[model samples]
Target: MPFALYLLGLAVFAMGTSEFMLSGLIPDIASDLRVSVPAAGALTSAFAAGMIVGAPLTAALSMRWPRRRALLAFLVSFLLLHVLGAVTTSFEVLLATRFAGAVANAGFLAVAVATAAAMAPPEAKGRATSILLGGVTLACVAGVPAGAVLGTMWGWRSAFWAVALLSVPAVVAVLRSVPATPAPTGGGGGARREARALRDPRLLMLLVLAALVNGATFCTFTYLAPLATSVGGIAPGWVPGLLVLFGLGSFAGVTAAGRLADTRPRPLLAAGGVALVAGWAVLGAAAGSPVAVAVLVLTQGALSFAVGSTLVSQVLYAATQAPTLAGSFATAAFNVGAAAGPWLGGITIGAGLGYRSPVWVSASLVAAALAVAATAHVTGRGPTSPDASRLQQTLP
Candidate 1:
C-alpha cells in the first residue's frame, strides 16, 4: 500500500493541480484570448459539468477491465484531454476540451479510491484513501498557487503546457509503480449485481451524506471571491493570499482525516460536520470585516473538506461489495452538491440578500449536514461499516 499509494498520489497531484490551476489562470487567459472574464469563467464550469456527466458512465463501461487497466486508461485519456485543452485557441474548443478533460479526470478519481482501498491494510483503508486524495488538498495549498505564479510571469498557456508535461511523468509512474490488482468486476450477472448494490442501505446513506457535504461546502465556495470583496471589502491583491489560507487548512484536514477515519469514521464525520457548521457560521458573521472573514473562511475550508474526504472513504468502505459503483457514485454526489450549491446561492443573492447571502445559506446547509450525520448515528442504520462488507477476508 505504501509505494502504491505514493505512486497514485503522484497522478492525483498532477490531475488535481491541472484541474484547479485554470481558475487562477483565467485573467491571463481572458486577456490573451480577448474574451470577457465570465467567458473565461466558463472554462472552469465546463470541467465541473463534465465530471457530473462522466462519472457513472465511465464506471459502468469500464467494469470489464481490471482496476489497473481502467485507471491507466483514464489517466491516458486525461493526459490527452489536457493536451487538447492546451492547444485550444477559441472559446468553443476550450469548452469542449475542458468538458472532455473533466470527464477523464472524474473517471480517474473514481478509479483511484477503489484501487487504493484494495491495496490498503484492512483497518487502514482510510489512510490509504486519504493519501491518494490528498493531492487535491495539496493542489489547493501548493499546486494552484504555484501555477498561478507561473501563469502570471509567463502567460496562462504555460500553465496548461506545464500540466501536459506533468501528465507524461504521471503516466509513466503509474505504469511502472502501481501494482496490478485484479479488476474488482466479476463473473456474476452484471444486472443482478447492480440491483444488489442498489439495495444496500449503507451505500444509500453514504451517497446522502456526500451530497449534503458537497452541497454545503460549494454553496459558499462558488461565491467566495465576490463575497470577500463586496462584504469583507478585501482589496483585489489580498484575495489570492486569503485563498492560500483556506488551502492550508484544507491540507491539514486532509492529513488528519486519513488517520481519523481508521480510528472512528462516524465520530470523526460527526465532529467534522459540527465544525463545518460552526466554521460557516463564523464566516457568515465575520464577512462584514476583512480580517475576520479571511480567518473564518480558512477555518471553514479546512474543516468542511476534511469531513468530505472521510465521508468519501466511508462510502467506499461501506460498499465494499460494489466498490466501482460506489466510487463512481461518490463523484456523482460531489457534482450534485456542486450543481445545487451555486444555484441555491445564486437564488439567495438574487433575492436582494446581498453579498453575504451565500455565507448564510451555506452555513444553514452545513448545519443541516450536521443534523443528518447525527440522525444517522441515532438510527444505527446508516452508511455501511467495514464489518458489513460482502467481501470476506480475515483481519490481519
Candidate 2:
C-alpha cells in the first residue's frame, strides 16, 4: 500500500471522529444554546442529510479537478466549517455549520474512495478500501471517547475546536502525500455521465445491499447503550467500555475484510451475514444477561463492520464504469443506511418495543441484505474476482 493511502486514512480519522463524537456532546450543546435536547440532536440528522447530498454534489462539481486538488478543497472547507461552528453562539448558525461541515466531510470521503481505488492495484482494492476504512474504526476506539472527554472537561466548543485542529494535520498530509495527477478527461460532463452506472442492475443491486447491510449495523449500534443498561443490567458507567469493545471488534473485522474481500467477497458476505443474523438473534434472546450482551456486542460489531466494508468494496468494484462517481455512490449508500437505521430503531423504541427491539430490527435488515446477496450470488451478479466483475467489464 502507498503512504498516500495511510494519509487518506489519517484524514478520515479526523472526520470520522467529528462525525461520531457529536453524540456525546449533544447535552452540552443543548444546554449552552438553550435548546431542547431533541432539537440539539437534530444536528446529527443535519450532518447525515448533508452527507447524502454532498457526496454526489461534490463529486459532480469536482469531476474535472485533479483528485489532489479536490481533496484539499474539501479538507480545507471542513476545517473552516469546524472553526465557524466552534465560535458561533447562535444555535441556528451552529446547525448550519454542522451541515456544511458534513458536506465537506462527505466530499472528501467520496474523493478518498476513488483516490484509494485508483492508487491500488486491481487485486488489492479491498485491502485499500479496508485501510481507508480502518481510520473509522480507529476513531470509534479512540477519537470519539477522547472528544467526549474533551467536551466534558472543557466545553462542547472545545470539541469543535479539536476537530478543526485535527483537520490541520489532514490538510498537511494530503498536500504532502496525495499525487497531483492531471484532471480526469472523461466523466467530466457532470453527474449525467456518472449516472450511467446506475443504469446497470448489478451496480444498483450492490448499492441497495450496501444500504441494507449498513442499516442493520446502525440499528443495533444506535441503541446499544440503552440495551446494555436497561436489559443487560450493566452499570451506566460501563457503557463507554462497551463502546470501546465494539470499536475493537470493528477494527478486527475491517482487518479481516482487507485480507479476504478482494478474492472471496461472496463467501465473506455470506458467512458474515449469517453470523450477524445469528448473533443479533442471540443477543436479543439473551438481552438480560450482562455477560452475553457484552460478548455479543463485540462479535456483532466485528461481523457488522466486516460485512459492511466488504459491501463497500463490492459497490466500488461494481461501479467501475463510473470511476469518478463510484465513491459518491458508495458514500450515498452508506449514509442512507446510517440515516434509515436510526430512524427505524427510534420508531421501534417509540412503539413500546423496548430497547431490545432494535436487535430484532437489525436482524430483519441483515436478513433482507442476506437475501439480496444470495440472489446476486446465484444469478452471477455479485463480486467474483479482482480484475473482473461478474456483472460487467472494467473501464478501459
| Ten residues in sequence with the least summed lDDT for candidate 2 | 387-396
Model 2 misplaced regions, further than 4 Å: 187-190, 386-396
Mind giving the per-residue lDDT tens digits that candidate 2 earns over 293-341? 8898899889988998888888888787788889999999999999999
- lDDT, candidates in the order shown: 0.78, 0.89
TM-score of each predicted structure versus truth: 0.91, 0.96
In candidate 2, which residue pairs clash?
none
Predicted model with the maximum lDDT: 2
List the candidate 1 regions with Cα displacement exceeding 4 Å.
Answer: 184-192, 387-396
Candidate 2, after superposition: displacement of residue 287 in Å? 1.7
Colliding residue pairs in candidate 1 = none
